[model samples]
Target: MSTLSKIEPTDATEPVAEVLAEVKKALGAVPNMAKTMAHSPALVRGWLALSGALSVGVIPAPVREQLALATAEYNDCEYCLSAHSFIGSKVAKLDPDEIERARHADSADPHAAALLALSDAIARGRGIVEDAALETARAAGVTDAEIAEVVGNLALNILTNYFNILADTDNEFPPVTPLAHA
Candidate 1:
């Protein structure tokens, strides 16, 4: 059971219903996170607005999902871990290894690897990363816009991760367990 009310599409009304429909239209399903967030229409709208903005960001969908996976693992949010794992592989077309590597904020591609490393630093440093982290990302071909988008994506993931953990949101996606990192 969730700490918060989990609104189902059938039970939703008015603003919540409209937003949930939009979510379903876009995603083909209303995820449990959105259903839980429907408890507050403002939260749903705020999340959608930010998410819509970031969809066109320089980070790309795969990398954005990678950051979300990394953030979910960092926070140990099972709901998000499972959800992103599904979205990462199914929607973003990332391979299983890439999805796993993302949890550790790693990637084989140098550009993605740099961003993931910066993501790891951001998570570990609590957003107070060292200068060299940014420098390294820049050196690896990350742009200023990419850095900004990474932070934006990180913030978005943290919002969902914390919300799901706080709400104890039931997992609506396939289960994914966290692995011990080296």
Candidate 2:
């Protein structure tokens, strides 16, 4: 159960319905999370804007997915953790073991271990990582632009994770639930 009241969908005309329509067209379904956001059109709109910004930002999709998954795990957001997990594996072709390994390691990737280490540091909210760690991330080929985008990725996941906790958004992606729980 959510601490926040569930907002049921209404067929009536409203900005929220427009957002819901866009969501439905995009996903072929009105996800419970979006529906919950429909309770406040502003929330849905904010999500849309932030999502668009992140997509157009400098981070590559794969790395952003990794950041998002890591952040969701940190927040214990069952819904988002599940959603992004599948997106990473099925859509992005990221190895399942890679994600599992990444979740616990400060250095998740053998080739790009430093980047993962930086991500882990960020996930821990250690706003002050060693200068050497930043140098390591740069050596691993992470750009200043990508670092900024990583911050956005963290923010987006934090938003969704907290929303799920507050809204108790039902899972739309089923396979992810067990993996997230484990």
Candidate 3:
């Protein structure tokens, strides 16, 4: 059970309902996590703003999704791990094997592998990534800017992961079901 109770669509009212309506229109469904976040509209709005800004950044969608999944896995966040895995497979066209490999931060390919390693390193709150790791990222064609973006993405995922743990948010998308507890 969730530590925070989700605000149901049926019970939404006034200012919160307005935001919930926008959330529904945008996502097609009010994810339980969003409902939990509705406890503080400012938090929800701030999260939305940050997400919007990040979406417009230079990182490829696949890389962004992979980073999110990797971060979630490192943090043991079932909610985000499940959600991002599904997004990785369906929205980003990442292969199932690749997704699983990313979840474990294990890969034969250096680029994908390096990204996983870098994301994991940041997820641990380690401010300084080793020079060799940065070199690996550079060899993968990742720029210093992209590395910074990955750090930002890592921070984003950590925020969401912590929120999921605190709220025990329910999974909304069906495709991620099998892997939710994996």
The residue-level lDDT of candidate 2 at 136 comes to 79
Model 3, range 1-182, lDDT digits (tens) per residue? 88898988789787788888878877687888889888888777877777777787877777788778777777778888888887888889888888877777765566667777877776664777677877777888777777877777877888888999888897786534324364
lDDT digits (tens) for residues 78-128 of candidate 2: 788778777878776778777675455333554345555677677675566
Q: What C-alpha lDDT does candidate 1 achieve relative to the native structure?
A: 0.89
Global lDDT of model 2: 0.70
Q: Model 1 over residues 124-166: C-alpha lDDT tens digits?
A: 8888999999999999999999888888888899999999999
Candidate 1 Cα errors over 4 Å, as ranges: 180-182
What's the ranking of the predictions by TM-score, best on top? 1, 3, 2
Q: Give the lDDT of residue 59 in candidate 2.
A: 66
lDDT minimum window of 10 residues, candidate 3: 173-182
